[model samples]
Target: MNDLLDRLRGILLDTGYTIDGVRERLGAVAAAALSREETVPALRATAGDDPLGLLIRLWWLGAPVPARAAPVGLPVAELAAAGLVAVEDDLVTAAVHLQPWESGGYVVSDRKVRPGDPALRPDHVVGAGGASANLAQLASRRPVGRALDLGTGCGVQVLHLAGRAAEITATDVNPRALELARIGWALSGIEGIDAREGSLFEPVEGERFDLIVSNPPFVISPAGRFTYRESGFSADGFCRDLVRLAPRHLSSGGTCHLLANWLHVRGEDWRDRVGGWLTGTGCDGWVVQRDVQDPAQYVELWLRDAAEQGTPRYRGLYDEWLGWFEAEGVTGVGFGWITLHDSGSLDPVVRVEEYGGQVELPVGEYVDEVLGAVAVAHRMSDAALLASRPVLAAGVLEERIGPPGAEDPARIVLRQTRGLRRSVRVGTVEAALAGVCDGDYPLGPLLDAIAELTGEDPSDLRERAPQALRPLIAEGFFHISTG
Candidate 1:
């Protein structure tokens, strides 16, 4: 199997069957259409007999191609024997979805179940999609001694962790997902991954890792019909349990990145509800709710996800899902990323907030810096913070909005142009403080000078400035200079 996968990898790479290659062949219109799950335009674009074109049609569009069109050295018979493809008569079709990921590797999973297709199998393994990309971007890229990809469906995250982690362990509850993941890893030429089969944290019992990442089956659904997206546990219990159990398996200073959805019940603050998961975990946690949807919206989205819409059971399933939400007192569902850093501090900092802003790509690059800043600001005393010199982060711009020719601006806002892209409204004193925070001088003297210029008492300014600046530091707008 390994030899066959090696040959398959060579054929794919040599034929330019990659994400970029496919996009270029499909062109702009066809590529965009395919993203919407409309494959006619793509099919039309790839009607030629080119090797890349034929491969795109067979694997990506899930369309059969003439067996004669198979490229030389493509081992069609061997692929058929391995169940990677099915050859009937003069046509060959892919049995699994072999996706060309951006990381220069292929992911093997169950073929996509489109609308009007049969209902999904009980143990269907899903291909890498938006959720997988989100968790990948959220995961820190620092080299680690050991890393774990929990619920490693199709092994996409393992591909991302290939070089960064010295040793990798991937675990999943479904044996089918594990099997496909192994196939994907072999095809990608990634090795030495300890693939274990068990439900969440059970396979690697009592072991710790330098990093753990998961895009778990976090959909809050009444029926656990799909193993890839629905945990049998009730009402976001899987995500909650995953969070609470993370710290136990995290080595000191280890970090865990997860994409999850949590319930928004009546008479409960969603912040506290989600934040409660991090309590007593002894980890500095940051939970950001990127999007929220009402019960009806959530139900419809998942229903459409399984391609169940327009089916006879669609309305009944939708009604059943909504009824479950109502019975569970769920008003809405909050979807977002959760990052936990094991700081080994008794006084751990946990922040839960909603942020809908444009952020730069590969947030993993600076996540540690952001979390470190937050921890420092959280623990620092006013006097200590004042004595320290801080610098404004790059890409921060000051915007003053007001009526034309007004003496003073109506509002002053500081906006980050990169990574998180957070914006905050500020006062004159804070604005003045931001202008001079270049790490050349201590914050105390700078606040004193701003106080004098703004006609406010230096004592009062000093008293209020630390609280104001702490948030800026926490959100990556201001970098507390350790130098």
Candidate 2:
């Protein structure tokens, strides 16, 4: 089996059969079509006896191939041994969708059935998909003594975590997923990732980790349709429960990164509802809501996600989900990342805001910087904050917008070219204040200088300066210099 695995790895590398390779082989049009779950374009593109085409068909397209094939072929017997493929009458079909997924490096997991697949089982394991990649990119790559990957479906997170965490523990509720994860780790020749089968924190009850991460079963569905998604918990219960318990399992100064969904009730404020979960957890949580959809839109999105859209069962599932949401007074659903820090503060700081900006990949470092800024503000007083020297982040840029023939600028916007790609509009005073944050002068004196120049009272300007700078400071527009 090891020899077969070695040969398989060689075949993939020798042929350059990676995600980028497949994209290059098929071109942008066909690769993009496949990304939208429309496989016909990809099928037309890969119709040939070429090694790359044969391999694409065997793995992604699920097309039956002759038992004997050349450099394009996978090791049939070994794949069967690993429960990845099944052969009958000299034709091989993929029992599981095996694809070469690349993140920080090579990560392989059984693919989930998409819109193009003819048949699918409830237990189908998902590969390194968008959600997985999102969480991985959002994960802090800082070296740590130990990490926990909660709900490690097919072990994609485990594979990514292995590179950073010294010791890793992976937990899941589904037994089949655990089985496949073990196979994946063994095939990849990666060890020391302890896989356990239990729900949520039950697997690691008495443990404390330096970092805790999860791409959990947070679909917010009414029933347990798929083990990878549903957890038989009420709407958003799985995610809420996980966030509530994460602080207990994290060591002081540790951080927990999670991808989650929270429902928006009709009359209740979503912030208080989601923020309430972290109450008494003794940890600071910063929740960034990336996308929000109404009840109807949310239902349709997940239905298509499961490739059930336009199927005979689509209507029933849609009705079931929509009806449940309507009955429960759910107006919308928000999806995004929740970052928690184990500060053990009694009055934990919670920042819940919507960020619809373009996201740069490997956002963990950026998040860490923002969190650090927020932490500083949490402890510093308004007077102390106004008295601190400051500077703009390295990626910040400013633009003056007005008519081409105009004298003075009408509006000034500060934009971040990296990280979250956030853009903020500032008034004249705020803009001038941002320009002088050179770390040589404190904001209190700067505001007083501006007030004297503009004929405004320095006392009033001092009060307003810190209040105005608070949001910008917390958002990384201005960094308070400790030196």
Per-model C-alpha RMSD: 1.0, 2.2
| Candidate that would win on TM-score | 1
* Candidate 2's TM-score: 0.94
> Against the hidden true structure, what lDDT does model 1 obtain?
0.92
What is candidate 1's lDDT per residue for 201-246, written digit by digit as tens?
9999999999999999999989799889999998989999999999
Clashing pairs in 1: none
- Candidate 2 global CA lDDT score: 0.82
Model 1: weakest 10-residue lDDT segment is: 474-483
